[model samples]
Target: AVTRELALFKVACTVEQRAEILQIAEVFRSKTIDITEETITVEATGTSEKMDALEKMLANFDLREMVRTGKVVMARGTQIT
Candidate 1:
């Protein structure tokens, strides 16, 4: 099996395009966490490759802020084989 890691992102878009921004986020399986008059923050989780693609896509938008948490893995008391 191909091991996949979870990466989270906080994408903030210009207030004027809050709804439109969601369309882009949805392509990468992201959800909104916070919204304001000037910005909207969304969270996305996926593999490194997926995250990279999503980041590239977001480049097309006007981002007020952006933050990404690198890949993370969890062990359930057992090692992978």
Candidate 2:
């Protein structure tokens, strides 16, 4: 089951900047159902280098108050169904 379409990334930003954060969705979305909190989520794609970059950026922006889940990748076009 290659869940490509189901791929996603769920990033939870600080409460004060949640709305302002989601607007920049493409910046951190990994295209997988990020089973994190109920706050925010993004849809994006990239490699390990990219993920590291994203993490660093998130840290620099002071947005990672808490991380709910580790990174998970889905196969192309694969879905839970």
Candidate 3:
């Protein structure tokens, strides 16, 4: 089976910290969906573990909010198991 999850992280950031935050998001293969003077929102999709790791990294900054979806699973073969 294959499993995946989606997460959105909102982190408070300063102008100087914006580049660093973007770098972390890049490393996680996440997309920066929204950005404001005070916050940056990142959208990530991967395994649960990956989401956890990304969250941990983002926590270094001022993590404002987080939203995560339940795991989505699908069978690999044509038949459902």
- Each prediction's whole-model lDDT (CA): 0.66, 0.47, 0.97
Off by over 4 Å in 3: none
Please give the lDDT score for candidate 1. 0.66
Per residue, candidate 2 scores C-alpha lDDT tens digits across 8-53 of 3445556666655554555555433343444455444455456556
Question: Which RMSD values do the candidates have, in order?
Answer: 3.5, 7.5, 0.9
Q: Candidate 2 versus the native: TM-score?
A: 0.37
Query: How many residue pairs clash in all the candidates, one count each?
Result: 0, 11, 0
What does candidate 1's lDDT look like per residue over 1-81, in tens digits?
343554444445665666677887777778777767766677777677876787777667755455666556665556564
User: Using TM-score as the measure, what is the rank order of every candidate, best first?
Assistant: 3, 1, 2
TM-score of 1: 0.65
Rank by lDDT, highest first.
3, 1, 2
Give lDDT: candidate 2, residue 78: 40
Displacement of residue 41 (Cα, Å) in model 1 is: 0.6
Model 1: residues with Cα > 4 Å off, grouped in runs: 1-16, 74-81
